[model samples]
Target: MAHIVGGIFTSHVPAIGGAIARGLQEDPYWKPFFDGFHPIHRWLAAARPDVAVLFYNDHGLNFFLDTMPTFAVGAAAEYHNADEGWGLPVMKPFPGAEALSWHIIEHLVASEFDITTCQKMAVDHALTVPLALSWPGADNRPVRIVPIALNTVQHPLPSPSRCLALGRAVHDALASWPGAERIVIFGTGGLSHQLDGERAGFINKDYDRFCLDHLGPEPEALVAHSAVDIVELAGSQGIEILNWIAARGALGPDVREVSRNYHIPISNTAAATMLLETPATLSKAA
Candidate 1:
C-alpha cells in the first residue's frame, strides 16, 4: 500500500525563495514565514518520498486561451521548462515517474474520470519554477514528477465537489497500484489573493487562515461553498483552492497538521506549507 508522505501548501510567488536565499526573511514582512521552512530541509531529508504527485494549474502557458481540459496528467518521461516570457530562467528538466503515472491514468480513465494526457508538451514555468526552487538538495538532479494539472485558468472550471472527487480518484489509483513504497501529494496554489487588473495585490490573511483551518478540519464545508463565493473572498484568480482539495484527499479524515505558515506581504500571494501523513507512514519509513 502507498501512503502520502505529507502535503505542502504554499504560494508560487516566484521571488520568495530568492528572498529567503538573500536573507530577506529579515525584511520584517517575510522573516517569520520564511524562517518556518528552515527545518523543511531536514524533513525532506527524512521523509524522502520516492515521488511527488504535483497538483498545479496552468496559467495560460501550456493550454493557452485555446481548448483546455478540466484535468490533465503528464505521463511523459521528461518535462522541459520553456520560455514563458516571464523573465525567469528556464526550469531544469524534471524526471516524471511514467510507470506509476501511466498506471494511474489507466485506472482513472477506466473509473470514468476524464483526463487529458500530455507527452510532448512543454511545462510552463508556473509548474516547474516553484518546484525546482523548493528542492535545495536537488542540484539539477532529475526527480520523478507526476503532474496532475487542472484547467483553473479558465472560467466554468470544475466545481469544488468535482475537484474533491478527483482527489479520491487519485488516492484510489495510487493505493491500488502494487509495490509503490512511498509517495508525496502536493497541492500548489493559493490561500487567498488575486493577480490581474487594478484589483491586483489584494491580500486577505483572514481568508487565508480560514482556508488552512477548513482545509484541515472541515474540507467538506469549504467544498460545499460555491466557486463564485470563494472567488469573491479569494479573488478572481483565487479559484486555485481546487488544488487544496487534492491535498485534503491525500490527507484523508484523520489528517494532522504538522506545520502551517500564512503571510500576506507579497500582496497577491499567501505562502503556506502543511505536512500530512497516516499512522502507517512511520512504519513505511522504518
Candidate 2:
C-alpha cells in the first residue's frame, strides 16, 4: 500500500515567487520573507517524496466566472504554468501522476465528495509559487504532482468542516492505492492580510499565529469557523486557510510537526509555512 510521508502548508503569495526568481533572498526588504522557506527547501531535499498532492485555488487562470467546480483534480500528464496578468517568470511544466489522479478521483466521488477531474489545466501562481518555494529547482526534481483546486475565490465555498472531511477522504484514497509510493500533501494560501476594498492592507498576526499554533494538534477548533468569520478576521482572501484545514485533516491525528515558519507583510499577505509527518509507527501500521 502507498504511504503518506507528510503534509506541507504555506502561503502562496506571488511576490514570494518574484523574490525567488530575481534571487532577492538576501535583499533587505525581502530577506525575512525568503528566510521563512529555507527549512522547507532543506526538508524537501531530505524527504524527497515521489508525488505532491497540492491543494490550491485558481486565480482566474484556468477557471473564471463562466464555470467553476467546488473541487477539481488535475489528471493530465503535465500541467504548464500560466502568465497571471503580470507575466511572472514562468517555471517549467509540472509532471502529473495520472494514475494516482484517477484513483483519487474515483475514490473521492465514491466517498460522496463531488470532484471534477481536469485532463488539461493551466495552473497559476497558487500552484506554481508554492512549488517554487518547496522545491526550488523543480524542473530537475523527481517529484510528480496531483493538483487539487478549490473555489475560495467565489462565494458558496466549501465549509471548513466539509474541506476537512474532503482531506480525510483523500487520506483514505491514497492509503488504499495498491502501490508502494511516498506521497506528500500540501495545503496552500493565507496567514491573514487582505487586498482590495477599504480594508486592504490589513494584517492580523495574532489570529494567524492562533491558527499556526492550533491547526496541527487541534484542527477541530478551526472547523467551527465559517467563511464569513474568517473573511472578517483574516481578510477576504483569508478564508484560504480552509486549504490548510483540509491538508491537516488528510494528515490524520498521529502527526509530528517537523518545522513551522511565519512572517508578516509578504506583499499584502502574512506568510506562513509548516511541515508535518505521520509518525513512523503510524506509517508502518497504515
Candidate 3:
C-alpha cells in the first residue's frame, strides 16, 4: 500500500516566489526568509516522495464569486500556473498523478466529504510558489503532485475541525491505495498577516508562534478557536491556517516535528515552514 512519508506546512506568499525568481536570496531584506528553506530543500532531496498532496487556497485566480467549490482536487494529467492579473514568471507545468488523484477523490466522496474533481484547473501561486520554494529547479523535480484547493478566501469556510477531519480522511484514503508509493502531504499558506483594509500589514508574532508551538501534539488547542477567533487573533486572511490544520490531521495525532522556521514580513505575511512525520517513521529513521 502507499505510505504517507510525511507532511509540510508553509506560507505561500507571492513575493517569496518573485524574490527567488529575481535571485534576491542574498539580499539583506530576503536573506533570512530564503535561509529558512535551505534545510527544507536538502530534506526534500533526501526524502524524495513519489507524490505530493498539496493543500492551498486559491486567491481569485481560478475560482471567482460566480462558482466556487469548498474543496477541489486536481485530477488532471498536468497543471499549468495561472496569471493572477500580474506578470509572475510562470513555472513549468506540474506533473500530476491522475490515478492517485481519482482514487483520493472517490474515497473522499465515499467518506461523506463532498469534493469537486477538476480535470483542467489553472493553479495560482498558492500551489506553485511553495513548489518553487521547496523544489527550486523545475527541470529536476521528479515527484508528481496532487493539488487540493480549499476555500479559505470566501465566507463560510470550513471550520478547523472540519478541515482536520478532511485531512484524516485523506490519510485513510492514501493508506487504502494498493501502490507501494511514498507520499508527502503539504498544507500551504499563512503564519499571520493581513493584506487588505485598514488593518493591512498586521503581523501577530505571538499568535503565529502560539500556532507553531501547539500544532504538533495539541492541534485540538488550535482547532478549538472559531473562525471569528482566528480572524481576530491571526488576521482575516489568516483563515489559511485551516490548510495547516488539515495537513496536521493527515499525519495523525502523533508526529515528530522534524524542523521548523518562522520569519516576519515576508511580503506582508509571517512566513513559516514545518516538517513532520509519523512516530513510526521517526523511529525507523532513528
Query: What is the lDDT of every predicted structure here?
Result: 0.72, 0.85, 0.85
Better of 1 and 2 by lDDT: 2
Model 1 ranges with Cα > 4 A deviation? 17-29, 137-142, 283-286
Compute the lDDT for candidate 3: 0.85
Candidate 3, residue 64: CA error in Å?
Answer: 1.0
After TM-score superposition, the amount by which residue 77's alpha carbon in candidate 1 deviates from its true location, in angstroms, is: 0.3
How high is the lDDT of residue 178 in model 3? 98
What residue pairs are clashing in model 2? none
Q: Compared with the true structure, what per-residue lDDT tens digits does model 1 show for residues 1-286?
A: 6666766666666566445345465788777666666565556678877787888888766787578889998889988777666555665677888888898899889889888998755676445644644574324553477888887777777888888888878888887878555777778777677778776877667777777887877788778777887788887767788888865775556665766666666645776766555556656667
Evaluation by TM-score, superior candidate among 1 and 3: 3
Tens-digit per-residue lDDT, 1-286, candidate 2: 7778888899998888877778888999888766777877776666668998988888888888678889999999999987787657877788899999999999999999888889999988887878787767647656789999888888887898999999999998997999877898899999897899999999889889889988888998888788788888899889899889888887777787778888777888999988887885345546
How close is each model in CA RMSD to the real structure?
Answer: 2.4, 2.0, 1.3
Score candidate 1 by TM-score against the native. Answer: 0.90
Model 3 over residues 181-263: C-alpha lDDT tens digits?
88888999998988899899888998899999999989988889987789888889888999999888777768878889988
Mind sharing the TM-score for model 3?
0.96
